[model samples]
Target: MAFPLMKRYFDPWLVRIRNLLKAAQGRPMALVVLFSLSLLNLSSEWPSNMGRPAFVGALDEAVPDSFRTARQLLFDQYQRHFPRIPTAQPVTIVEIDEETLATVGQWPWPRNRLAGLIDAVAALKPLAIGLDIYMPEPDQTSPDKVAANLPETAAALAAALRALPSHEAILARSLRAAPTILGAAALDHATDTASTDLRSAPVLVHGTDPLDSLRRYDYVLASLPELQEAAHGQAMLSVTLEQGVVRHIPLIMGLRDKVVPGLPMEMLRLATGSSAIDVFADGSGVQAVGVADVQVPTQPGGDIWLHFASIRSTLSRYVSARDILKGTVDPQRIRDKLVLVGLTGTGTTDMRTTPLGELVPGIEIQAQVIETIFEGRFLRRPTWLKWAESAFIMAFGLLIIWYVPRTQSRLAVFLRAVPKGSAVLGVSLHLLNVLFCFFIFVRLGLLVDAASIFIILSAVMGCFFAPALLRGDDPIKTQARDAQGREDENDRTGKAPGP
Candidate 1:
């Protein structure tokens, strides 16, 4: 009696489950699995929604890293196909190249020589002059050094050398006289964490304190104290490079909890005569940095995405330091133009890789940033864009979930034509997705993670087809089975089977 009662209570639920499983044997089962997997992929907080992870959380980090490399390659191809033309901006690089080194003496030329260069550039009446070179120590070849190195027997010569002005003083005087913006570097491993009283240009904040949210450094390596005081502005020259490429440049960074402008930002500020920069930020991070009336957008840590100009075009923008010193360069190029002084000499380690795959001077990277800001052609990925991307992924995933099952059902009904039809449909869908992703990227300047999307699509197709192949339910196997059944019947009837 007890056994009968138990069977009556549980038998209906067990039967329903069995019937449901039987109904989901082929196409329906595949669809249900694909949909569930898609939901798991899209709803998760993984770096990218490629597909449902075979094992959750274990491969999460590796997937995004691989996708990033692929995305970078896609971006590189995009840039190659649609290279940016150089804008007619009045920004020039006064490069100390191999030619300049051969013409002028080797680098570490006396500070007086740099002073002379400054004076010459100032005479051209540039809008602003930025030294992408840093002066961490006093000139070693100064007259004071010579005097210290001399013996007592050469007292008269030492006296003459002592009477001569120090190289630092001369450079400081030039800095004071010209519209010069000095360069400084932020040190990550600096032993000194105490903030030095470096002369930083005034930067006023409008919305919220963006200092705490910016990339911070332990210490700053600035120009000589006198030079810093005399210069129109002082800013950081440290650049951040990722995977050997410079894609973004920091416009504002923190050193020992103090905010400092980048070399390019200071040059712009000095050029526009903006005494104080107005930074706008909120809980999200830095939105934009303003100088006078012009506003420039930035990434979370005050870095600007660089839309690098073609390398061929950048060649003309370089004015050799030798020419600048010899007065051979055209004044029109310097007059009212922003001049960046940096070393591009052969032995210099200032070379950096750009999106174009060519190595360029670090100063050129800064110049690109400044020029981009001036032109207001910033590449930005707004906060809302991620949500839009997620929506796209979800929508596409759903479409695949809905379409693949129907395709499987149709293929089963027309098993004889399944091989040819599946091939055509699969190729078409894959190509369509590729074109769609590329179009959105090129047209809208949005990255849609094509790699991840493709992975999801492939996963869906594999799930739908793998079971059929394994169960001998594929088109060729089904036809073979039917032929074998007819042959068996003919043999049982003692008649020869027909082909």
Candidate 2:
């Protein structure tokens, strides 16, 4: 048969097959195929986009660029539609900002000043106070400052924790007393630590190879030995940032075969007094729990999903250290509040630029995560989620075959024709997967990555329409044959050929 004739005859059948595949009942088979593909892709990171521009363009009119209000709208919308109400173990912040400098001191303010800040926040008598700041090493000027001032700070901070003696020992220590998590970013540039401040380091949360990722990091070790000597608990606030957004913070990483916890989990242990933290990540995703003794096996790496909280909600509630210092804010309000040491300064430039080029506040991001942990609401995408994604695609692909050719409405037609279906679908899969990791069941802890979903769509399209385009190349020959058949029918009907 001629190429055009062959294609013209075959195109419709292939399209029908696509519809049939969508209508396929047992999708677990497809899941098995896709899941096997995922397993073969054992690399730890999501595949990079070769045509990132095209992918971005697909989202151009869809996802607008607006950090301040856009991000808020997204969270609120997600909360409303998805409604993962966070069970926040409430905490406050003593942001080290310009104003904080005015009230407290400069960037690397004295250990005594941090001691006072601890005392002030300690007065709240929270379940625990966590320092997001780091104290990896000791201070030069005060060789014994962290150690020396720790006792003094404990003395003053003790006043607050006295009522709750356990709170004092566990919650009031500056990197020493409070359930502590230190911030440390792996140095991005191999520069001298000349102007380096050990207060807090930027962190990179996720990537394929930890060494290959250009995700920035900063060291948060303490500058005072005295400070280092007095803490009850300590862990890294390590981040695996993407583009620039601080997305996932690994609860722990492999270093000389040592197991560690991230900042939030460590502090959670202090706040809740739980000795065991169950870490879960199988085929679906990762989950962290503050049980007395967790039984999940250790992988070579880990990153706890960020349980996000809305920024407006976070800022409306949290008062800065500087505000508390000047008495602009009443201490009574913060009394019994769990406070976090963070950075939300105007000039802080503590902004992470996302793939979408949106600059988000690092502190606000942490606040959201804190709320996620506290609320027990996490986004989860299990291995089953990928199967679910494949199912959705197949189902929709069938619907497209049925509905697209018959539907007359351009609006409906546009919806079917565009990639929007894939976006909505992809986002749904990830949201379910990630959120589930933070809050409830960490089932099928597998990372499907966005690439898998894209691949599914491509496969469906290639199967469905490659013939349609080929058949269109020879419309004349196809139409001629179609006319000849119609003529035969007309001759049998004893009538002229229809126009």
Candidate 3:
């Protein structure tokens, strides 16, 4: 009686297991298992291929460019939809706008006119004034040029010209009197020449050979020697573009074996009365650049990821050059403010594409960089982020392999198997990964690409289920076979089969 009871208890489960094995034994099912395992193996190699160009390119293409655009749009929308931290530090832009050009005349205005504008802004006692314009050559409207054209009174005119200072000299005097930071450009051409008279700001390095790993440039195009000497500080205005968009700005750039500060960095130093910039690095590369008490985190090559705010929302930040020069504007507006003087008139060719869309001024880009650093809110991808992503992909892939097969087997045995279940699981996993990445990006300002992992998950599901769904023996056939076997067993035992 005990033996009969034990047999009754184990017989049904044993039969189900045997049917599951029979359904999963055909060539079609074998191929599915083989393909799924192959994908698992391929996924294990993804981390090592992270640095390869082909692998990187493929990962970039995995998500459509439209998705990137949409991501940016979403970022903009969120910033607009939410309330931001109120800033106590005032930063202003003295723009050479269309209205200013129409009022003060077109660009390349007489050096005296520019000198007057500087003097007017200086009177307000701003924190620091940065010139985004480059003065590479002598002014065309100088006293000497005017004297040379008046040949009829050449002898007397030469004496008058000598008595009156050159336009450049007047501008230099104004620059020396005011708090000014001059901007320069980095060039890729090896033969490019920079002003030897201009002095570079002092840099103090805190690690072994940090400059060796920085983004190196062949030469720099700086301002005129006299002007550079007169300015309080000099900074490189070089900005690297990514796919025609301004995403990251370099805080320090390498020039002929020497490291130089970028415009935003130098301006901050001058504003805070810091004499030298302190760069901290390790074997990996530069870790941070410090000015006074503020330290900014940077990439290995001294690039900082910008957290952009919409220019339209910050329109009050700009003050027309004409208004500043005419003394009609309120002095309280710019008093103790950090002022950036740059050209923003139409056709200036200084516009850039930002996350907010096209036609952003290059000056605003630098302003945003300074703002981001000052706020200490940056977007960064930690060194271990990729490792975390790779580990996640591997673990999830293995889970699917283990869990999905058992699920399919059980479903097939119950005559309830369907392809939709696997497809639904794959899509749900994809959506969960997307939501996780989005949360990290918005909350912590970390960007981790989940597209590659999604691809791996989808592929694994497809390989595991496609063959089984298409060519494997139907669940109905398995059910029929089990019923017929039960009937034959009952006939041999001389009993009636159950309905």
Clash counts for the predictions, in order: 0, 62, 0
| Off by more than 4 A, model 3 | 1-89, 190-198, 407-419, 465-499
Writing each residue's lDDT as its tens digit, candidate 1 over 187-303 gives 776543323546888888777788766998877778777788889998888888868887778888887667788888788889988888778887667889888888888776788
Q: What are the lDDT scores of the predictions, listed in order? A: 0.74, 0.47, 0.73
lDDT of 3 by residue, 403-423 (tens): 554423564344344544544
> Each prediction's TM-score against the native?
0.80, 0.55, 0.77
What ranking emerges by TM-score with the best candidate at the front? Answer: 1, 3, 2
Please estimate how well model 1 matches the true structure, expressed as its whole-model Cα lDDT: 0.74
Better of 1 and 3 by lDDT: 1
RMSD of each: 9.9, 13.2, 11.1
Ranking according to lDDT, highest score first: 1, 3, 2
On residues 314-348, what C-alpha lDDT tens digit does candidate 2 reach at each position?
55556778776556776655665555677666765
Once fitted onto the true fold, the runs of candidate 1 whose alpha carbons sit more than 4 angstroms away are 1-66, 191-197, 407-427, 441-444, 467-499
